[model samples]
Target: MESLSRAGQEMSLAALKQHDPYITSIADLTGQVALYTFCPKANQWEKTDIEGTLFVYRRSASPYHGFTIVNRLNMHNLVEPVNKDLEFQLHEPFLLYRNASCQYTVSGFMTRMTVTG
Candidate 1:
């Protein structure tokens, strides 16, 4: 009888531990998280990417900031408040121009890799 009681107590304790949000780790989720992919073939390159907004939705996260996959900016300007999706061209770099304070421009080609078949 005592062993059964102990098992029930342990089960309840485990359930409470799982529900305790303070103890569990939480993400400081800001901006958009995306996977930028590219492929290189001899002298040419191939690329495919998903913007941040779509990436967030696919991962079951709230996309409050925006899309920023193919974009690359300086660490300073990367914290801007983006909304919905980032409507930029494909394979262009959204760079934080070193001269400007918070300027972001989409230009240049992205680095490439070997795309999987």
Candidate 2:
């Protein structure tokens, strides 16, 4: 029984490593829009619109450690039709960088729109 349990644990760990070794905590942000205002100068506020498919993960060795966000352009880019079934794949190389506040980091390409009121 002990040997079987040990073998099962090793198999599970191996499967996890084979799935995704770098990225963790991924979320789908398809068709989501974010609205915010930025104060560039005194008594002035600029409205901004951001929309994309967000992919968040944590990678210790990554330059942008801690929490990172990725904007996946295509919804189906991360998945494919395999034998009539959908299979996930991590193929994109994200360009990581810290935000202005230095809190977290953001990666990949995202659409940014400036709203004029």
Candidate 3:
């Protein structure tokens, strides 16, 4: 799993563009999900599951608020389909998958990894 994540991070944009389009709709891909998130505790990317909506990132005070989307488990390296409902906020950092062809399903903000005091 770790190796797959690393390989995905190493994928160049040029290579992704050459791959086939993410030729499926959300309804079609829901059951066949491939989720991803950055774990600060683990200090690496990890696979996860999504129930409904996935918040990729919230607008942070810092200027650097972009996120990376990766193709963790998908074999074909399909692109992320654009959905108007998937995006929110204009000025704030929006969910922009760097590689249009990488297969990582949904990118979003997850509270599952929070440390409890």
Give each model's whole-structure lDDT.
Answer: 0.28, 0.31, 0.31
lDDT of 1 by residue, 1-117 (tens): 112255754553343234331222111222333332222344432222332311011112233322223223322112222333334344433222221233223323333211221
Residues forming the 10-long window of minimal summed lDDT in candidate 3: 22-31
Instruction: Flag the better candidate by lDDT, 1 or 2.
Output: 2
Ranking by lDDT: 3, 2, 1
Error of 1 at 40 (Å): 34
C-alpha TM-scores of all predictions:
0.21, 0.27, 0.24
Residues 54-113 of candidate 3 have per-residue lDDT tens digits of 212222233212222334443433333333323432221223232333432334443232
TM-score comparison, 1 vs 2, better candidate:
2
- Root-mean-square deviation per candidate: 16.4, 17.0, 15.3
Backbone N/Cα/C clashes per model? 2, 0, 5
Q: In candidate 1, list every pair of residues with a backbone clash.
A: 39-113, 40-113
TM-score of 2: 0.27
Worst 10 residues of 2 by lDDT: 79-88
Model 3 clash number: 5
Candidate 2: list runs displaced more than 4 Å.
1-22, 27-31, 35-37, 42-44, 62-117
Question: What value of lDDT does candidate 3 attain over all alpha carbons?
Answer: 0.31
